[model samples]
Target chain A: MEERKAIVEIKNVNKIFGENHVVHDLDLTIYKGEFLTMLGPSGCGKTTILRMIGGFEEPTGGQILVEGERVEDKEPFERNVNTVFQSYALFPHMNIWNNVAYGLKMKKVKKEEISRQVAEMLQLVRLNGFEKRYPSQLSGGQKQRVAIARALINRPKVLLLDEPLGALDLKLRKEMQLELKNLQKKLGITFVYVTHDQEEALTMSDRIAVMNQGYLDQLDTPERVYEKPATKFVADFIGESNIFEATISHMTGDTASIGLEVGNALCLLEKGVSYSLSEMVYACVRPEKVLFSAGEAEGFNIKGVVKEQIYVGNIIKSNIIIANGQMVILSRLDIDEVPKVGEAVNIYWNPDDVVLMKSRGYQIHHVIENASLGGD
Target chain B: MKRSYRARNKTIPLLTTVSPVAIWLILLVAAPLLYVLFLSFLSTDGYNVVFLFTLDNYKNLFNPTYLEIYANSFLIAFFTTAICILVGYPFAYHMARAGKRKKTVMMVMLMVPFWTNSLIRLNGWKTLLGKTGFVNTFLQNLGIIREPVEILYTRGAVLLGMVYILIPYMILPLFASIDKLDHSFLEASNDLGANKVKTFLHVTLPLTFAGIFSGSIMIFIPSLGYFFVSDIMGGGKSQLIGNLIETQFKAGNNWPFGASLSMMLIFLILIMVTVYKKSGGDMEDLGVM
Candidate 1:
């Protein structure tokens, strides 16, 4: 497929703070009207990428193109982008109307036009009748909305949001996440959002870029990034997964048979070719895909004792200790069919449900098991 | 019965925390202000004390000669405060924004001048600005002037002395205010399309107004009553309200009139403070850390 024309293109950007390289050789293309989120853990340089795109920080190397023009040397005000900071950073001295009108006023817009736009923005954020109220008078969610309104009222080519809903409660954050996604779609504005919350990224982004340790692991549609992660880091960061150590036994077409310590398991290689027979590999499968049995009767199954059972409202998470003793598999069962702790059960999963990747130096099967079993 | 009785009975601590602070306030602030107020209303004639309630001292404060001195003092202090702010703001901002080592060095530099006695500093300035002082010598040596310029015993010298003495007081508070500013707010403003100048005008200036006002008040009120700088640096040729008040009390033997002038200065300060408070300004919101 042809590459999408980028409204904002960041090419080989690098940022070094003293001896620490915060963002290294980063490259990304933000499509027009696409809601893209850079998701990562703390200190992974997600916010730095967003700030660089907004022209807040000058990259140590490479170039940034906004609307097909190089803007590396442009000041933040000179660039046609605005940011909604995590703290909202609303001017406490100004009222809601003045706060929303700040950007337009800076552009020397006509007074009437500024008022009209500010009012329209207030309505957009559902903050009507709050024009006279100071930021201190508003609630946390209202402040966040006002921040969004303030950023959007500028009508920049791209809007950058750095964990804009991080300070709000869970319910409000989820609500604002959806509202922000809808607002972006309705306005048809390019949004480059930064967040450490994977669920937030998955829920709102048209495309999610999974980052780890200042490196882009994968950038793809939310479904693809979740279901078919391009790297082991992406798979582990996005959601809960049960990864097993396996050796590639055979390969035919898209199907590969992997030999595990418990038994021989089959995995579907969706889009990788750097593999050979008898090569050590890691298999990733979602916990929901793992099936538990009342009795032992399966073509390819691993027998394990249920070490712990956690009832998590909609789902029952069970930690099963495999025969290897060191390895543990996590299985998610429906809350209606809960399993008893210390009960022996056979864990099985379909071949297509497994994702195979070339194992790095260390395996994470024991780590996941230890976490599930509440091990230190 | 024992449990209910115990629950119903409670005893306050033997030594409440506020007792010491209350005693200190009474001894230092309240008592002195009360005595000054009492003295302002009392009347005296020559060497004899006439304990009579009279409005003569208050009336004498409105006389043209005394009023001119009052206005001169106000103008001088106001100008000194303005200059202090102009010089101190950038200095404080630089100090606040500097790195740890630079900030420490600048803070020490700012405070070092204050360690010297004000009288000594004023005398030093007087010597520097005198006819045969270092400045005139240097200027004469460079052929910039054929004769020694008379800068001492002038209003400019007095103003300069006041500003130099009061600059550290202004810079310290303003530095505290500027230092506590959220850097992200500036970045956010810049991202929102405000230029450097606009950001400074709209965000930085207004946010630090409380500190500026505080520093101004501190510098202005004290400079109004200061006589040593004007007397020493200005060579006794320039007479400010402080000199007038001092002459009335010590030299002119008019204690009642001096007490009245002091009361009037207090009233002016009160009015200024009330104006500041009525303007809906919050000192805490000035970003004072």
Candidate 2:
């Protein structure tokens, strides 16, 4: 794959608010015309990164480059990036037309050109008739469209959106998600979006940068990030997966044998990555990858009892307790009859379907604590 | 029957909550205003008011001397309000953006002067601006001036006194409105490629305009009627309509004319308020209710 030149580069960015270190030594590259999302939980520094890129915030200890030029000293207005704020910060006093035309007017653009561009941008956001409505008079979705129109009217090289659809209802958010992705594709402008919604990130972004505690856990295409997470945090954060601690028992060419208490299974160590015998590792397998059978099965299979079964529209979700008493979830299409609770079943998975990652030392402890606390 | 039930429910709540304030307003405010209006329509003889109804007092209000005093009062109030805005705006903006602890400290400092009587404070200013007092003495000793310059008892002194007394009124409402500004709008402006000045002009100033209007009214209206500051600081040469009305009631013994002047001030205030209401200023911003 040919790597495109980056439109925005964040290098060793750190932000400290009072005594709290919010963003730490974060580095990222947003390629031109790419829809990149920074996904994380709240307070995980995703919004801070977006703000730094939009020049709303200054990195305490590093440089940010836009179009290969350092913009650390530039004010927000001096930068070529615009932001769609989460609150949809449309000026309360101005109508939609003036709000969208504000950037062009600030640049002293000609009156005819300003109105033409404003109208075009409003139409692009599907807000053509809302030109005369104040922000307070518009619905949340309409306000969001106006904010997007206002930001895009400047024709900035990169648009930074900080959870722009977070205020909408779920159905509207889903619709706007597709609309925004389609808009980005049509405009061919780089989008640096911040969102805590992993599903939204996966649905819209060309690439995802998953963040945890101010560090980039993984950055890759959505399919790759989902199928082969670089770290345990990314695997646990991006989707539903059954993660367990396993000990490496043997190593072979491009593969390794990890021991489970009830049985042993063959798992592939990451290519060009080192693993040692008797080392602890985190093994993740998506619920859909775990196949369930009513009887004993051959090849890396474990005998377990179905503890609970839930029918969710098109899929059946069942919690199975293996022989060693470790619990793992199994999901399968509901085309087959529902598995009876307390019925004995065998769970099987192919070795290649599992992902092996080095332990994120404290994450296991945190998850364990959370699980224990969840019990009444 | 249902409509009548609903009306009864609403009326009971309204009566319970609103009647006390309405009665108090009628007794203390409306009664005095009506008495003044009636007095303004009556004729006065020497120190006594006659029962006969007349418009002579209202006609006398157009006298050139009274007109000049009204003009002086307007000019003084205008400058006081303008200066208050010029000084208070930046101060309020700074306070609004300060850190929590710093904002609290500044607010307390702004309120410290209010603990003492404003009259006493104006007297303190008189001492400072007096010929033998702090400012002139210090200037004389520094050889900047050979003699103590006349600093007190001037038009400038009256304005200084008025602004000093009314600035707190200007600052509080301005602070409330400026501080209430959604900071995200400023960020949005910056993101739209507006520099700080442009952001302030296009975003901050327009949004905080209600504060400016309310604060201006707060200072301007009171400055028009506050006679003590001029009496203490202006040496009588800067007598405003307030002083003229005061003299008419006291030394001049012309109660009808004095009542007429009070009514005129009220009329001006009403006009100003009407203009404010028409200009999109929120009545809630006035903090009157």
Candidate 3:
């Protein structure tokens, strides 16, 4: 990425509703014209952060600077920020034209300019002929487009979207994901989107901000977040991972020789870190990164029985239980033939594939097992 | 054939749900209304009413004396609705949007007057406004006036009585509508660069207009016919259409003329209510929530 300028800056912002600390001391900066997604499970304070930026919520502490102006104490309309609400929030009493034209009308823009802008906005959203129809008359996708149009016509410095396509069906959500990404690129407006859907964040965001338990865990590019998660909760959230609790037996240069339940493993150490001898840690590797060997291969020592293979399109997912009853998940392409269930197989991953991090006191597998029980 | 088959199967449940209200409306409501219509067309002597069809009662409605009463009734009912909107709207808006405890307190405050009989409440008001009442006596004691003020039996007193008794009807519908309004709409409005006042005009007010319209109906229709309020507070000095009908029934001994007046008022109410319903006024929005 090129040198980016900051458009919205949140410094040590905290939000507390009643006795619940929704957002803890958080510091983040959203760049100009980049599509950033705040991805987390429910109750992770992503929406609260978006609300704070849009001025719907005031932070209990800290300051928010949009375009270098202090905005935490301002009303939503006082700042040049608009929000596309989760429910669309289109005015039921107004038709499509009026809904899109609402901001301009409030600004006391000339009536002819309002008319021209409304028409142009409706055309841009591909709802040009729907100006007379109420929100109830439109389909979910159309309403979503209208909501986007309504906010964009205001030319807000930053557009805050709270799960804008959450109400759409699966196919439409996919289409809208691409459409919104393209629209953001075309318009070049900073968009701060919030969602619980990890796939959506990965698909649409230029950078993804993964959060957990009111704490921003990692803010990085989608590829880096997927491949090099900075925290245990982020690794658990973005995708499936096989986390093995291990002890660093020794450090040889930039590699940490880890002792796993199955056997010894080597994980490449990240730079600028010194590991003490016999330090407890976790080595996480994605299921698809593990290679299944047909026969005894060089340096392939660990062995497990083929447990279950789930066919999902071209990719096949298999669960392998080692001799000690420790289960490991492996994802492979259907083109690569694997042993049938109950058949013994050798499995190993390259040192670069393993992610080594200091233990954060909780069992990663426990969170993984209950992760689907989403936010409160 | 499939739709017809389904329709037949649906009839039992539909009839079960709808028949009770239908029967009640037809027997109790429609029957009395038809009798009143028949009575309005009959002739009445100074002593007894005769079941002879005549246009005399209808023609009496065009007389200048009754015309003045009709105009006064409209004027007072209009003012009552206007004042109720000016006062009750803010009260309902604030109460509906208030925090839970404050909302409950305000709701209880609005409903406390309804706990007692309305006539008894009006009589209580008569005390505060009557000669040597609390207000006049207090004023005299303060040396603000040398003599007690005559406040009762005036047009202003009648208007006050109507507003005091009917303001609750205005409040309930507005509260219901404002409460049921989607909270996101207001946030969206504000996010779209409209301030609080502009959002109220552009979104909040339009969305809750159903409540205001229905509340006006509830208040204005009843204020027109609440004879007891005018009788007790205005001392029957400011005669409304209700007072006119009441006198024709009791002292005037002219039942046919009274029936004609009632029929005319019913038509007027019918037109207003029809317009209200046509303009997206849903009773469900009248704060049923």
The local distance difference test score of each candidate is 0.84, 0.88, 0.89
Estimate, for each residue in B195-239, the C-alpha lDDT of model 2 and write its tens digit.
889999999999999999889988888898899989999978788
Which parts of model 3 have CA positions greater than 4 angstroms off? Answer: A261-263, A293-304, A322-327, A362-376, B1-27, B286-289
Which has the better DockQ: candidate 1, or candidate 2? Answer: 1
DockQ of 2: 0.73
Candidate 3 local lDDT, residue A328: 86
Record all residue pairs in model 3 with backbone atoms less than 3 Å apart, i.e. clashing. Answer: B176-B287
Across A68-180, the per-residue lDDT of candidate 3 in tens digits comes to 99999898988878899999998988999999999899889999999999999998888999999999999999999999999999999899999998999999999999999
* Model 3: DockQ vs. true structure: 0.76
Screening candidate 1 with a backbone cut-off below 3 angstroms (N, C-alpha, C), the clashing residue pairs are B153-B234
lDDT by residue for model 1 (A1-376), tens = 6666689989999999999899889999899889999999999999988888888888999999999999989998788888999899999889999999999888899999998999899999899999999999999999999999998888888999999888889999889888988899899999999999999999999999888888998999999998888778888888888778888888888788778888766778766477766777878888878777876544566788888877777677888888887345465547356558988877777878887777763335345545766545
Off by over 4 Å in 2: A1-3, A250-257, A260-266, A295-307, A321-327, A360-376, B1-31, B49-51
- After the best TM-score superposition of candidate 3, give how far the Cα of residue A287 lies from its true spot, in angstroms: 1.3
Q: What share of the true interface contacts does candidate 1 keep?
A: 0.88
* Predicted candidate 2 versus true structure: per-residue lDDT over A260-376, tens digit per residue: 767666777787787777777888999988876776554455678889887789999998888877888888788865568998877667778999988754455556656866537
- TM-score (second chain) of model 3: 0.89
lDDT of 3 by residue, B1-289 (tens): 9999999999999999999999999999999999888988988778998879998989999999778888888899999999999999999999988999999999899889878799899989888999979999999989999988889888899999899988889998888888988899999988888888888988998888888888888888888888888899888888899999999899999988999999988998788788987887774654453
